[model samples]
Target chain A: MSYCVNCGVELEQSLGQCPLCNTPVINPREAVCNKSPFPEEKGQVEVVKRKDMSILLTTVMVSTSIVCGLLNVLVYSSRPWSLAVIGACILLWVILIPIAIYTRLSVYTSVLLDGLGTVIYLYMLTFLSESSQWFWGIGMPIAVLVTLVTEFLVVCFQMLPRSFLTNTLYSFTSLAALNIGMEILIDRYLQGTVQLGWSTIVLTVCIIVNITIITLLSRKRLRNAVRKRLHF
Target chain B: MAKREKPIPRKDWYQLDLSAIVYPTLHRHDFAPVYRQSVLLTEVVDPELLQRAVDLTMPRFPTYKVAMRKGLFWRYLEPNDRPGPFVQPDIKNPCQPMYFKGNNRYLIRFYYYRNRISLEAHHSLGDGTGCMCVLQTVTAVYLRLKGYPVETAFSKEQGYFVMNIDKQPDPEELEDAYMKYANAKFCPPRPGEKTYRIRGTKESFYTLNIIDGIMSTSAVLAVAKGYHATITEYLNAVLLYALLKKQESDRRLRLKPVKVAMPVNLRRFFPSKTLRNFITMIYPGVDPRLGEYTFEEIVTQVHNDMRYHINEKFLRGDITTNAATKRHPLIRIVTLFIKDFVIKLFYTRVQDHNSSAGLTNMGALKVPESMKPYIVRFDIYMGQPFSSRTNCAIISYEDTLTINFASSIIEADVERYFFRKLVQDGIHVKIESNREMTLEV
Candidate 1:
């Protein structure tokens, strides 16, 4: 006989609270007594375990790296050519292990680990040849810059309220910065003088796109029109 | 020596009806086209008696006692050689995704929670009317097992809904009536626009929140009679209004069409007796962008819309198009791989794009008079829509018309507005839910 005071709809005697508004149902004349509509036991779909996939991946990568290392030492004793294959296996393992094994691994940690793995692989490649200067000057700086820019973009996407315009603005701005940073590092390594040629064109186009996006963000009607047209 | 019993003759396999061809192709791990129909009894259900009832009723439904198998050209239903699915304790989550490979290949699952006996069947098996037959029979058998003098017969004069378990399976019951009644000469094109969708925070994939608003059928029917509309039309108007109000609360212009898909039972219009998904959806909607409408105006629009679309000629044209497409040389010659890809693409992109929400009124269920004294009420609950946030189903037994809302989101605004609107219309509603809400002092 109890009714929700807020919704004004009578509730089942079995219900202690109103389902619509979550209001307490208390009738001083009647004691609340009846079984619920559903049972106490709840069932849920079983999530497929990723641990088996992680074990399989580890076995494959480890065996491939071992086979390549043994071939370089025993069969092809002339040079250590297997370093490249082993480095590739190591890089892939580092990137996929986090995704397959852990659910709570943050995007920031994954991107940083990928950067470190790439740097190590490049360093390993330098061992096959006598040119360590290219790896230090070009490979190290570019990989680190790409990873840092990606991490910054991920942070921006997470921290800010996301819409089509906001996400595009973040992307174009980061693209320009990454392009400029890469050119500077490449210029320093190749010619020892800072000269911007192709990056300026990219920077100009990015600036124009970013300005257009900013304009669209500021005007609701225009943003809605573009959304309707683009069907995003 | 023990006396030997006579073996019942049945078909080993059945073809997927015209309407059923798309459901299996559109099935996903997160989505399955499943709906539930349950009966509430006066006493707590005994699991042993319920299991015996299920075991007795499973063999009577030839079209339902089968499992899905992939054929070279199409997927077909073959009789499951294993035993019937065992009855299980009902869970808070009623209709989860169903897979055919497991659980003895049973397409239908039975659950008992206290006085409620629920039957969750895949849409591919049959429509609500078809499954209702199985549910009513199971309930009647359970009552008989519990020492009630419940009589069962499948006389067409009385009605085709009630089943006789001892009789042999009929070939006409297993026939695909869609192919039988499809007239290719009257094929009509059904073009649709992308309709507005209710946006909300997504809950976990496994969670389905069910809220039931139990009300008196006479009270609601009297109100509908006042409006010069049928119960389905009146309820649809109320649902659309509730959705419109929810959309307007966002303080945005209500430009998108607020439409609810109403599933019409083909048996009412045609003479077909088979129960293999003979239903079509009619979208009765209001174009809020056109202008503001009063509640009376919306009712008139929905009433006229439903009256205009629900006819034998129009529905025949619609089913004709589907049947023609299925029988086309290009469609039939292709292997199932290509057919499945096309069907999946069409279903995901175009099928549910025309409706804001869905409302299915199974219309007052008629229980046999002998078993009426022991039954409390009947309920029909639709599973979550693939695109819409919530969908509703209605069924009534005796004087109680239970409106069940199945939602995938965490919000209760839609259900609140809907019931409050009914209460405002002078209909008394009693609310209950599978979810237990907290009470603040």
Candidate 2:
């Protein structure tokens, strides 16, 4: 019998390597591998199919929109309230179509598609209301700002070096920044001024907290102290 | 030719034990509380004989034939008349969810491989010891039916390492030992210490990869003696050391203590022989906050902890506290849905966070002298870890100790490191894994 060189114990004749250390056997005389105790066929996992789920979702969205549109035409015969349902159905399709078709889409592509879908849905609402002026002035700007801020936060959080504390700090700071930008956009569009109110306080507090975290992280001693105390 | 008709008998039902109540409530798509015990024989398994064996053995172990049912205040077990799943050829992963989409006839299933007969049991039905006893009975009956001339003098009383077959099962086997023995003295909970969790890419299909390292028991015991520690303590130290090595490579892991939750079989401490869930867990490890600990130091600490914590008094207090919480009058009145929600929440938040990985030592498998030569080895595979992806179970028979490392992750660093350390400590391990060598993690 060959012995495992690493563990200095006798190796079974059937073993290909040292079971404890996984060190490959190197003996010329004992090169024959023994049959494994496990089954020859590898175990196959039964994966739940998502295609059926996607089909169900698509059917529900399409039917609801279609039924609402028909009822609005035949029963009420009033305003085209079905336009809202149709727009929502289109938005849902735009959001879910890519996910259903390509299960492994990158985060960047998903965020972009979601942002574009929201903007198109808002435009649809503006078109139905017969008021295109405010679409460019308020709705477009708000949607664009929200989408851009979301994309920025997603990319930053994913790309930047992360620790638990730093990640929390980054998320809060991004939130505060997005809130300030949204307030500015709203004020400029609605009141024709770049006035900041509650957002200023939020931004100031977030910046102070970010600075404190940055200082603590930069110093090894302080970071260790905080980690030990917080137990994160 | 006319088929004989057997009259259907009235079904029997039983209440869920204190420890078993958590299983049916927390069972989900991903988390299936099932454990498997298998015996390898010299000859291939006969499906027809095995089915007959199961039919004969079911009457002996009454609890194995029941299905879990939801009750108004608590979940209970009801006798199911549906025939147990036939002894099908082993396929699919080891421990798939027992409660399938529409099938919940029985909580245990019997399957046959080339030369292995396995029994997968839901934790609600019984613990590893109970499952092993059932498997042993089945094997014995199978061999007898196969004309092997196996001895059939099985006892009715449940005892450690004894196969109780061919006789009536004792009612004590179904007793809720925890509730019966619980002394409500308000013992404080054990210290809650966060451990260094092993993180890796989980298997894409959520399949478990089991690596069974067959080693000589005497060699391992010799090494354990060299370290002046028991086999369990020695292996726990090795596992902790492996985790520490992984932490050394990945700086992202918190420098918490690398602890392994060692499950203590209560049969050793208590006189009860009930096969239901009756074990408790104890966390033993070295606190990294106290600075780097040598292998010797870690083993010493583990040995001391196991020695102190596995006593009858300490285990009594531990189980009493657990049973007392479940035995609360207010908790008894809560609706089943609310109770399930509360237990699920407590399980994920509090219980799941207590340990990084579990190492269950099933000790040894004993059989009648006549059937010993027909058997090759015994193995135990604990279900996938609740929170972590990897957990370990050990079963020894004769001179061979089969340590099965079951992981849902694609990484083998922990297993590799642990095995290599054992080799370095002068123990030879013959490694066998289901993973292809080219795809080694």
Model 1 lDDT tens row, B218-315:
99999999999988889999999988888787576546888888898988888877867899888999988888989899999999998889999888
User: What does the lDDT come to for candidate 1?
Assistant: 0.86
lDDT of 2 by residue, B1-441 (tens): 124334334337888887788887777667688888889999999999999988877876778888778879998888777867567677546777666322436788888988999988888988888888889878988998999977756554423344445455667787788887778577757667556777887775446677777888888889999999978888889988888887777786358777788778888888887877788889987778788888998899989989889998998888888887787899999999999999999888777767777899988777788889889999888877776557889888889898888887767778877877887887777766665333121
Every model's TM-score:
0.77, 0.73
DockQ of 2: 0.15
Q: Cα deviation of A26 in candidate 1 (Å)?
A: 5.2
lDDT of the structure predicted as candidate 2: 0.78
Candidate 1 residue pairs in backbone clash: none
Candidate 2 stretches greater than 4 Å from native: A50-60, A86-132, A191-205, A225-232, B1-35, B47-112, B119-126, B141-155, B158-183, B194-260, B268-274, B284-307, B323-358, B368-373, B383-392, B398-441
List clashing residue pairs in candidate 2: A19-B429, A19-B431, A20-B419
**Local distance difference test scores for all models:** 0.86, 0.78
